[model samples]
Target: MRNEIMRCFAVVFTVIMIVSGCSGREETKTAGGGGEEDTKPTYEFRLAETHAPDYPTTLADKHFAELVHERSDGRIKIDVFPSAALGEEAAAIEQVQLGAIDFVRTSAGPLAEFNKDYAVFSLPYLFDSDEHVWNFLLSEHGDQLLDSLESSKMLGLAYYSSGARSFYSSKPLAGLEDLQGQKIRIQQNAVNIDLMDALGASATPMAFGEVYSGLQTGVIDAAENNYPSYYSTGHYEVAPYFLLDGHQRIPEVLVISMTAWEKLSEEDQELIRTAAKDSIAFQREKWAEYEQLAEEEIRDAGVTVTEVADVSAWQKAVQPVLEKHGADYQDLLDAVEALRP
Candidate 1:
């Protein structure tokens, strides 16, 4: 599994570098009458996504691209590559830094590998609720966190609502004790692995593409994700019990390559930024609609919608994981604690 995942990542880097790094895409204007060079400029940008076209993240990217093109009067074209056409987000992130790709939409899990400060947001129950998460993202502190990526050669443009993630398994989760001994598939990362360990479940990390099959074959007893993803990926076909524990409110982000940003004219830069921030409202509304639709439809399919009776117990159990991980990044933890709903 590890070798296959690495191979997937390797192919992305090799192919994308040749296309983006070794060449530049341009849009040029023709001289009106005289044999003079065209002064007007043109640009073509690439936006990478790991979700299907109908997915919320991909829909938002398309909407954002449309707005950019319309707002820029067609001088800027943002070609949206859905379903990881360019590469997985993790691989595209490095390419984004080198200007091999212009934009990416991904979860916070892979992003933390690029910046430790992002680790705070990935921690379980870090926010009181969705509104609390939004408040922090829109606050002055949130802007600072967005700006934090400047050091990493990327710019955090806006946050898209991914909703809260919960566990869905072949069997129902009655409470915290139910998690003991279950083999759960989590994002391949230290924080997530440690999170499962703390809960007494064995963490199995694998590619997202292989998850549906894994669950069907009993390779993993349970897998966790947002409701839209759970439905969209068809994981519910195997894991019929979904516990609305709402453990992690992992928000997705739209990022631009800093190297590419630097090359754009100041006026164009402002337009891109404005369009990106503007897409938040559109994406959030679509997300809310999808969340409602998924819940209603999934339950109607005879799947059990289990409610987490005692969240306090789950939070208490996961506290040690947060404490240990937060020790290295104390300021951010303090910042999260300082955030009041």
Candidate 2:
């Protein structure tokens, strides 16, 4: 009877030990699974623009944010700050270069300082129409220009529409003669300054954010931008005349810091590229809609909208600028001229 009881106790002890060992193994595997999950990195990206959230570029950025989130399976996220929320265009570009900011949507004018090839886009009458600008941006030449930023630690993702920048002033400007001796605000680009000077205006380089105050205080008698910007920034209230000279059709760039870009997985990179392509299409549509809406809004606000009889008059005035910069910008000029209708 003693031997029988000992055998039974031994069997029970072995079974309990086996069961506890199995449980321990399962617990170890569970802990390892948790650790692996924790190892997955969560990347957050920031995008900054100098326009309002309602603008086409901002809308496209919002779409970009959504696409990134969806494509990355929530592993990546993007936050957009518009209306110079981060800083002015030049400041934002510098931040991206230093990796202090992840992304920026800035006009080619500011970017030209970093990459001289971009200066071609700032030349007056480089693009004849919206179609011309759009086609060139989608071409191989455009890709080459955009990719050139790689050396600067900035990667161009896509180009956003800046529309055509013409003149808006408190006084009427029918042609080049009307602009003689007038002070006009322009982006701090040599080509733009030259273009304004050629057209007989005293070009003053100023920040877009300061234009309203500058106009109000009579620091600048005129300024130029696209129709949407004129309405969105309320510049029309102060400068109530719009001249459709279409001197410069500068496109805004969507760029990412190379530091941030390289951190993304291959799959994430594909996702970004695909999303940017789609967002570009979306932006173009929104831009068309807003252009009409802005025109109506500004007109209703008592701004005079005038279409010049001869854009050639304005173009001729800026011809000297092209002559000086044309050799260096020949490739871009040729590309623009080659764009099919």
Candidate 3:
């Protein structure tokens, strides 16, 4: 009876050990239950965007994330936080500078606050047309400007079109002459402030998210942005007068933190750069579509749309602004001028 009892105990102990070993193996298996080894991504990153999720920039951000994931063969993942979920552009950029945020799609306007070289894009009437802007942005000088961001601990991965900025006001603004003494909301940039001053308007530096309330509460008499922004933000509801002056054609820059970038292998870096460039086509196409739709929708909504048929007069008004700030960006200005017809 004692031998039989010992034999039973031995069998139970062996079975228990075998079961534990199998469970250990199961726990070590891939998340997909494909194999015995784990297959999680090597790196996971976050990208910040100040635009709404349905906005063109946000869509392009997702596209960029998808391409990176694909090109990296799932070894990498990029999660995009849009609509200022992370923070506003300025705060987000600071976070990125500190290496706390992996990436951000910020306006060149706010970006200039970090790297003054970016301020060139905010100069009013710098580009004759959208084509002129793109030509310069795609040229050798544009690449140099992008590379110069390294001084600020960031990298300019690519440029996405923000369209051209124009003024919209709570009160009627028939022409440049009407802008005198009007309190206008502008981006927080010295160049933009100077541009507003040169145009004879009181420059109220305000955040993008605050413009709607600013307009409604009369904190600002006018604000300037593109057609898509005016319509999408519903700024047209309160600011019924939309003047298509196209003052600034600042590009939205896709920037990555050098901290996060350094951790990536050269191959992955190249992959991300390519992915960002590839995403621009989609973003620009959507921008064009959205722009036209925005104009039409705002017009249908009874917003007065004024076209600057001859921007020469408006251009002449901003000459001092260019002359004052132009010295800092002479090389870039020369390059930009060379691109014009």
**C-alpha lDDT of all candidate models, in order:** 0.85, 0.85, 0.88
Model 2 TM-score?
0.87
Name the lDDT of candidate 3.
0.88
Per-model TM values vs. the true structure:
0.87, 0.87, 0.87
Residue 248's lDDT in candidate 3? 88
> Where is model 3 more than 4 Å wrong at Cα?
1-41
For every model shown, the clashing-pair count is: 0, 0, 0
Clashing pairs in 3: none
What candidate 1 gets wrong by more than 4 Å, as runs, is: 1-24, 30-38
lDDT of 3 by residue, 36-119 (tens): 565332677889998889899999999999999898777677889988998989999998998888899988899889888899
Top candidate (lDDT) = 3
Weakest 10 consecutive residues of candidate 3 by summed lDDT: 21-30
Candidate 1 residue-wise lDDT, 43-90, digit = tens: 778899988888888999999999998987787888899988888778
